[model samples]
Target: MLSTFILSQTKFDDVNELVKAGEFTKASKLIDEKVKTMNLLHEEIFQLQFEKERLERIRKDFNKTADDILKYARKYYPNATESDLRKWEDDGSLEYKIIDGKKWYFARAASNLFRINKEAKKQKELIDGFKKDPLDVFLESYTPKVLDESANAQEKLVKPVTFRLNYTVTVEPNAVPNGEVIRCWLPFPREGHERQQNIKLLGINSDEYVIASNDNLQRTIYFEKVAQKDQPTVFNIVLEVTNYSEVNFIEPTQIKPYNKNSGLYKTFTSERAPHIVFTDKIKNLSKEIVGEEKNPYLIAKKIFTWISTNIPWAGAREYSTIENISEYCLTRKHGDCGIKTLLFMTLCRYNGIPAKWQSGWMLHPGEVNLHDWCEIYLEGYGWVPVDQSFGMVDSEKEDEKYFFLGSIDPYHLIINDDYSTPIFPAKIFPRSETVDFQRGELEWRGGNLYFDKWDYHMEVEYIEPK
Candidate 1:
């Protein structure tokens, strides 16, 4: 009887019946119960089997994409030594790419690849299934609740607008001087009009002084002057707009003012404490250098020094989230153009120097994009341009330290203000709190447009006095 029970539990019903034949009807009922139980067990086994198969298929697809990326990387970078590949893998510099059915990278494994692949595949299946379904489906998506969505309530809205920025700087005689340059890089516009071209050059102001426009990166204008003696000079620049299209104007625009209470402001204030380079260092270094609270030139020099020495410029252009530059300066100790400019602005504000934000596109022939920097307000000078990102100060150069401050190369054009209300107004869609300083976008109706969708052009004219 014990053996029969054991056999019955082991799924051997025939053996269980042979040991308990005298209770034939009871044995028959027991077999019926066992059969029902087996059916449930079979269903569970089939489900597990199906799951294993599905997972295996997903794994195979992911491995295939990874392999393809590897093969492409090897083919393209044949000269790359094995050590280079290993180092990239170790440092997590490599990633896999499968964008829009086109592969983007051929590199080592990326930790996110597995998850991305799974999610992408699932989305693809969902989209495909929706297409096949005869029933209509409603897809609900969400957008931010910001202003700017009501700009286009009517047709014949206002045309797009453009602005021109000019700056002048005066420096001490025999001060090592370097030329100033401008950079205009904007986010590529989605629609409207596109950038047509850029024109800039140089001329002779006098036998001792020459005016040259540094027009590389297309949109920046650098006004460079090399002075042999400590003397005063003036720089004139004009940015002209052509072929621009009009768009509706939106309001409630509040420019972000230079905030002394900001963390960035505190950092610069602490760094520029009494007896430091600007105050005591200047006193110790030269009798000619003097500290005056109202001296814009001296304040400008100090701001330049703090930016060039303290901030390390790097490219975090493709980041999905906006980083807190002040916090970054406090922590990682590095940043890109935006971060550096903020730091510069903060330092100036802490010391009662007035500074603001300016940004636009640096137009290349085939490419025009957005860039950012700052401007400082001086008592005698109004608002003077400062590009801390390019290390326009003398301290930024390794061999030639402290040469470029108060001067710039003539190669740039300004297209937009740093913190103005948007041209088209805000949309309900979520927009980046930190504007890219180049192009902004909005979508409501089925249509799309870019900076090129409108008729817009920029011209730079360099004037040198005879």
Candidate 2:
């Protein structure tokens, strides 16, 4: 039947004769079947055509140039191997780019790969229990302890603390078009239980000018160009806070840790945390540890351990704001030198230990920078300096990593006192004051807060610790 069907379907004369002799109708039926087969093939061709267009669109969307991919990969991986990058491309994990005759991978893809690597390392450390190096361990383990409030009860008994204030002003030549005569007013500390009233002009040099004031009023040393200059010239002015009386030891003024309530105090305290961390450790270790047998030296050792174990030293995002330290502790779980010191101070204050603030910028022949630590009042020993941020002693025994609390390096320039005092003579424009001592002003040329504004800066030096 199949042979007869084939013959009838053929278009040759012999085949036609066969079909006519046997069954032309069967041959016609076979021809109809072949036509149906052709129609089915046409449908397949249409489906393939649609698929081709769809694939083309997908290729366009996924396509990336070599240069683009390479640039992104370099930025993201920074140290990734070329082979690995190629494998990533093969795996369809990254896109490529070509720009300026260069090849690159997508930055996002590279970053993803790098993240995976870091996470792996972190996990390995977590699992291995390989003791982190002293420094690494110290950075991870430091926390500021709470101070004992009872110890500071004597703060009220001590004489009002006093400090000498000193400053130098630089007058620029040609600062004004003409030789302008300038009058300067110096800021005095503010009013409270303390009194700062006496004023004195020590001396003046091309770069050296000095003024002295009694009483704790926040004052601004004003300079008026009495004579205008054609060329910019510089002059130095100095002022001294020769008298800081300690009427009594004040308790932690704010409820927050390390007196975090005041914005200015918070900034100064946090800015100086690293140094405080070390000092706090020493203070803690030197204590009796509550239940342990009392050994002053042993206690000091424990304090050092506690400091190294608790506070993690890291740079702060912004040290200028008052709440910088507290906020940092809350989020990053770490802080710079200043904040650590404040934490230590707070802890000591809470535990009946007397701790106070101390800070200054390090000044070399050509550079000056800010630094802070603390001081504790000890019986008979008086106030001794403590720089916990520098770390513990016998530093060589534990490596540089463990040397942050209890001591300080020599590269510091001390500037301000432990507590914030207002600028003296009351700024021509009244300004808000803070414990960490930041001074800002708003003025009205007239008798109102809405006067035209002016600004000033004060730089202090410790010629000799009084």
Candidate 3:
């Protein structure tokens, strides 16, 4: 069960069983029956109510039918056949579920199939004419330059790019009563990092808004607005930040053994249940991959290389619905940026390497979107950026091939230093995004508003170096 489940009673255990077995209808019925009979605590009642919402979210993610998948796949593969679809499903390349005697593919399955399957991507490129991910193309040109600059300058951070962004969130009309107050928490740039600095708030839409302190692990800019009849509620913030590409040229000879008594090492290496647990599977895989490696940096490199080569990136479902994100990614054999990053962090922690989450947005030109990566601590080197999703690049040079293992590019907008941390002013309801906080959160006195109730957009203007 997901850590979100608040109740520990025996009946709640039964509900958990039903949910695990995909008996959502039965689970909902059981919840209703228990609610009518049991003297549940307020938190218990809230958890029970949310179980239904969780089921609804699952349905939304797994709503596409077999026919729909076929129609979508044919857009790329005109000769796509049912046999090919079944092969993909069997191999876990195309995720689907058997729901009530019918097949329901993941909403993003069609597009993800091309991403995870090499042959599918080849076919699509043949039809669409040699396509490449813009971000990868961008990296190919700048990675060598950033490494060279860092080496020559004798500095970790180099190649700074300042950006001006107008981030906006709009709630659909009549999402709540016209007179009701809506609370929103927009993603704010995290302060006090070597690579991400000079954060400036240029302007904001709301006259009265609370900007959380720099120390809030998952930071935000909170606002409250009264809904208007037949009009959408909107919140906006304009900010400027200078991001730098970090290239830590790690020398294995200078690396020191970790002090076991240190708090930072202990806290980050220890298990955090539900997400970063050191399960049997995780421990076994760590041993298989990390064999006799004693150097912390070397151990981390092995983990990063294994994951990048094994787990192909794919679109993921909402984080709130997942029980264990790392385990889920490991089981599915594919995941998005956040999913791969979690698995990487978990493996590093299991090997006694301190790893922590870092995410906000990727400010790549014409390709801005929410993204995730992590940081790992070395005794002598301190914490360095590691982007498992970016992984190993195709280059003969050591610096460029393992760029993300100990370094990162300049396009990051880090909004959260740690995962699953509380927002400032305290949210009355559970956050829509339990893990990462990039999209922004909204709620009313009535209840928390899920992603479907509103939309968010970011417009980035690169502040060219003067």
Candidate 4:
């Protein structure tokens, strides 16, 4: 009788049991209703909702078993083998879960592998006919002649461009309780950087918006709107910013080493958990990459070249959920811009070079998209930009080849000074994105809303040249 009582489980405990047994949908629905009844803190409620919702979504379209995934991979490419599938999944190039005692892979992951692997096999060259693989499509058309001919060192400063931006954030039709306040945060530019400045909020659709202090690393403009029963809650803002192109002429041999005791040196070299860290493998790899190089510039150059040549760009899993982003990239040999940036920073830091994270929008004439890059600190130069993703292994022109190593064009809409740092007015809930905050973060009293439950859109226009 005592054993029977011990074995008995509550309704909430049953949900946990179901989750452990890989019955995510059942578990999700079970605890979802009890969410309202549970006397939990706001953050606790938000995390519960977020986790359950994510589990259900992952189980929804990603129901294919191992055999099913293998079959799908073979369907697209006859050459695919069980070994290849296992390898990709382990490397995190493909993602999955264990459901009902079976290894299930996301349908999207299978499709990505099928499409990318198939095309990758056929390409000796990509984008166009070229002698070597061009670093980037934009780089192909760029030439040194574009620089201001009359500009000398004193006049080499970048002119700012007036960026007119229209940004929007919305929650799903019925994501939260009816009439509950949906708090939204939109990314806002800060006013500290020498290269990027003059941030002005020209207008906003929501009259009640709060701009965070200029010193906030991850600055945002907060807004609150009451969710309607069947309608989506939307927040919109319009702003203009001035951003200057960043460039630094380097004399590698004459450069001085940083004072090891300085705060800037100490802060950037120290490890930040989850993303930037020096694990055994990372430290070993850093040593291997650096070899005998004592010069920071040369060490940076070596690491940049190696990563660019090795890691081909691919769609990546969400950064918030990943444990160690730099290790993930280094081991996987494939990563998007942010992943590559983190890897570069980690390797640099491991070798006594200081580095930090930066992210914003890459405003090209054709498209505006989220992008990440890093800042490396040198003694005399202060902080210089380094974008391993914008590598120049293929470019023959010296100017075009080394352009992004320590400089950036004026097309950047700089957003976050540092990644993963908190924003103003402090969130009471676990953030939707725990790593890199770009699109925005949203939450209410009941729970935090994930990306699947919301949508965001951005538009950029050139108002004037500064």
| Per-model lDDT | 0.37, 0.38, 0.87, 0.73
lDDT of 1: 0.37
The CA lDDT at 98 in model 4 is: 77
lDDT order of candidates, best first? 3, 4, 2, 1
How does model 4 score by TM-score? 0.82
Please write out the lDDT profile of model 2 over residues 251-327, one tens digit for every residue: 22211232336444344333233223334443443343433533322233344455545555543322322323433
TM-score to native of every candidate shown:
0.36, 0.38, 0.95, 0.82
Query: What is the alpha-carbon lDDT of model 2 when measured against the actual structure?
Result: 0.38
Residue-wise C-alpha lDDT for candidate 3, range 315-412, written one tens digit per residue: 99988778788888888988889999999999999989999999999988878899999999998999998999889887888789899998998898
- RMSD of model 4, in Å? 6.9
- By descending TM-score, how would the candidates be arranged? 3, 4, 2, 1
Best by TM-score: 3
Candidate 3 global CA lDDT score: 0.87
lDDT of 2 at 362: 33
lDDT of 4: 0.73
Better of 2 and 3 by TM-score: 3
Local lDDT at 289 for model 2: 45
Selected candidate, larger lDDT, 3 vs 4: 3
2 or 3, which is superior by lDDT? 3
Off by over 4 Å in 3: 1-11, 76-83
Q: Candidate 2 regions off by >4 Å?
A: 1-235, 238-320, 324-331, 364-367, 397-413, 428-466
Predicted candidate 1 versus true structure: per-residue lDDT over 280-323, tens digit per residue: 32233223222454454566576666666655454432211222
Model 4: pairs clashing at backbone N, Cα or C within 3 Å: none
Shift of residue 411 alpha carbon in model 3, Å = 1.1
